[model samples]
Target: MNSETTYLTDLAAVLWPCGGLLGPGDRGMRRRVRRDRGNQYLPVPSAHNPRVILPAYNRSAATRGITSFAQGHSLRERARTLLLTGAFATGMAPLLLRDRLYVGAGPGIEHALTAALDRDLSIAIHVGPPRANRKPVLLLLTPGGRTIGYAKVAVNDLTSRLVRAETRALRHLAGTPLRDVTVPRLLYEGEWNGHPLLVQEALPVGEQTDRPTRRQLLRCVTQITAVAGVRELRLSTSPYRHSLEERIVALGARPEAAPLRAALRRLPDVRVPFGAWHGDLTRWNIASTARRAFVWDWERLCLDAPAGFDALHYDLNECVQAGVHPGVHQWLDSGSRLLRDPLMSGTGLRPHTVSTVMALYLIDLATRYLHDRQAESGGRLAAVDDWLLPALEGLQERAAHEAAGPA
Candidate 1:
C-alpha cells in the first residue's frame, strides 16, 4: 500500500483496537460512530468502496483501537478526523463515479408545512415530490375535502429578502380582483422554511392541453389589460410600467437601442383604458375546459400595465416557439375590429389605440428574439445587423402608417 494508505490504516487500527476484518457493513458502523460524535458522513459508492467486503476489514481495525481511547477529547478528535477524511473521500469518489446525485430535503419539511396550514380548517396533504430550489407544493384539503394547490416558494439565504418583498407584493395583489383574475383562487397564505406558501384552488384537470385556442388567448389579453388598469385606482405602486429603453440598455445593445428608442419616442402617446390584468399572460399559464377558461401561475401579475403588453408577450412567445395557430390571428383581427368600431370604442380607452400598441409591441418582441438568437448561434451581432436594422425600420414604418389611418 502507498504511504498515505498505510498511514490511514494505522490510524484506523489505533481507532479500532479489536481488529478482525473490516468489510462493507463496517462503513455503516463508522458512520454511526461519526454521527454520535456530532459529525456528518456522506454516503460512498460501492465500486471502489465495495458494500460487502473492504469496509468490513477497515472497520474491524478502526473499532479495535478506537474503543481503547476513554478520554472524551481524544475520542472527539479521532471522530472528527474520520468524518473529515470520509467526506473528502466521498467527494472525490463522485469524480470517478459520475452518477447524478439527488439530495432530498430532511424530515423538517412536513412539520413546517403542516404547522402553517393548521389554522385554515383544511387538512393539509402532501401533493407532489419536492421540486428544485427547496420549493415543495402541498394540497390543502378543505373541510369539504376539496383540494387546493399551494406552492412553497423556495428562497435560499441569498434571495430571502428579495423573496419576502416579492411575497408582500403578491399578497397585496391577491386582495385585488387581479389576483385570481387570471389564476386559481387564493384561499389562504402563510410562510414556511423562510419561503411563502399560497393555497389556491386547483385548476380543473386537462383544462390545459397541448394546443391553446385563439379565443382563449384573446380573452386572456383582454382580462389582463382590464385588471392591470385597475391598479391605477387601488394602489400607487406599479410593477408593469418598465421602460423598454432602460431594459434594452442594461442588456448591452446600445446600437439597437438607439433606433428602437427613437421609434418609441415618435409613437403617439395613445392611452387605452385598462382594468384588472394578469401581468404575465402566456399560453402555458392558461387553460380552458369546455365551459370555463382558467389561468394559473400568478407570480407575475401586476396591477398596472399597458393594455397591449399581455397580447404582445403572448404573441411574441408563440412566434419564438414556432408559428401560432390560425385561431390566434382570427382573435387578433376580431379585437382589431372591436377597436375600430366607434360605438364600443369609448368605454375606458380606445380599442384602435390598443391594437396599434399591440402591433408595435409584437414588432419589438420579434426584433429582440431574432437578435438574441443570432448572437447565441455563434454569429456576430454585426452579422445579423443587416437583417435586424431593416426589420426595426420596417416596424416603425408600419406602426406610423397604421397610426395615421382613421380609428
Candidate 2:
C-alpha cells in the first residue's frame, strides 16, 4: 500500500503538467481508457471543487491540445490541474450527466456561477448560450442532474445594466396574460463580485420541427406583446429605425448602398399599431409546444413598437439568415402579407401605406447586421449583399412600375 501511494505521488510530479489525467490510483486506470477521444473535452463533476463542469481526462499527445501547457503555472493553472486530476478519481464519467460533453458556462462565467450556487449538494453548471438566452447563457443543475435555473452573469457595467432588464421584463410578463404563449420565469436575482446574476426557470423545450408558419408566428407575436390600454399609432420609422441607421452608418457609403439608404431616409413617418416588441424575437429564442409558441430572452423587450413590426422582425431576420432564394422577393412578400392580415393580428394598418411600411422595415431588417459581416470578411456578407441589393432594386423598380400606372 505504501508503494502504491508513493507511485501516485511520483506520477503526479510527472503528469500534473500534462493534465494530471488521473487521481491517486487512476494512472493505470486512465491508461486503459480509449485513446481516440481527440481533443474533445468532458465535463466531469467534483465534490471537492465547487465548479460544476471540470475537465474530465485529457490524454497527453504530441499535438497541441488541453494537455499542452507550460510549467510553474499561476493559481488558475493550479485549479485547472486539480480539476483535471481530481475529476476522474473514480475513473468514471460525471454522474451528473449521461452525455460526454457538458454545454455550460466557460471559465470566466463558471467561476461566478459556482460561487453563486452556495450549496452543499454538488451542482452541475453548464454553458448553454442557446438555452440560456441564445447568446452565452449559463445553466445550473442539481446533483441528481436536474436543471434548476440559468445564471445571468453580468459581462460589463454597460451590458450588465441591459442584462438586468431581462429579469425585470420576465417579472412584468409574469402578471400578464401572454395570451396562450409562455416565457421563462425569473427565479431569483442576486449579485456576485459586483456583477448581477439571474437564476431563471429552465423550462423544457420541444424538439425543432418545421419553422413556425406566418399564422403561427403572428399568433405568437400577438400573445407575447399584448398590452392593455396602449394608444394605437402608426410607428413609421419603427422602434429599430435608429439601430438600423446606426448599422447603415457602420457599413460606410457605397454607391449601391446609397439608394437603399436614401429610400430609408425618405420613409414617411406614420403611426403604427403600437405595443410591446420582443426585440430579439427569433426561432432560437422561441419554442413551439402544444400548438403555441414559447418565447424566451427578454433582454431586448420594450414597451414601444409598432404592431406587426415584431412579427416582421422575427420573420425577416429568419429570412436574412436562411438566405431565402429565387430573388429573395418571397421573404418580403410573406412578411408584408402577414403584417397586413387582420385575422392574424389586432394591429390595424392602412392598405395604401402597408407596402411602403413593409419595404422600409424589411430593408432595415435584412441589412441591419451587414456592417458586422462586412468587418468579419468572407463570411455571409457576400450572400447578404447578393440577396439584399437585388431585392432593394426590385422594390424600387416595382414602385416605379406602380407609379407609371400599368403602362
Maximum-lDDT candidate: 2
Model 1 residue 155 distance off true place after TM-score fit, in angstroms: 4.3
lDDT of 2 by residue, 1-407 (tens): 24323332232222122222323223333343435221223432322222233344322210111222212135776576455443344444344323232222222333445565664222223322111121224545544434556666554453476568887888888888576676788877876445666867765553453357667777887765565324454444455557556666666765445666776665555554656778778766776754867677788787755556677667666665545563255566777677668854465554444555566555654564353243233433344556666666666554444434421
Assess each prediction's global lDDT (C-alpha) against the native.
0.42, 0.51
Question: Model 2 off-target regions past 4 Å?
Answer: 1-135, 154-162, 191-196, 207-214, 228-230, 234-261, 268-271, 317-327, 363-386, 396-407
Per-residue CA lDDT of candidate 1, range 113-202, in tens? 456555432322111111112122334444344444544444444224433444554565555454223345555566654455555666
What TM-score does model 2 achieve against the real structure?
0.60
Span of 10 residues, lowest total lDDT, candidate 2: 61-70
TM-score per prediction, in order, is 0.50, 0.60
Q: After TM-score superposition, what is the CA distance of residue 192 in candidate 1 from its true location, in Å?
A: 4.7
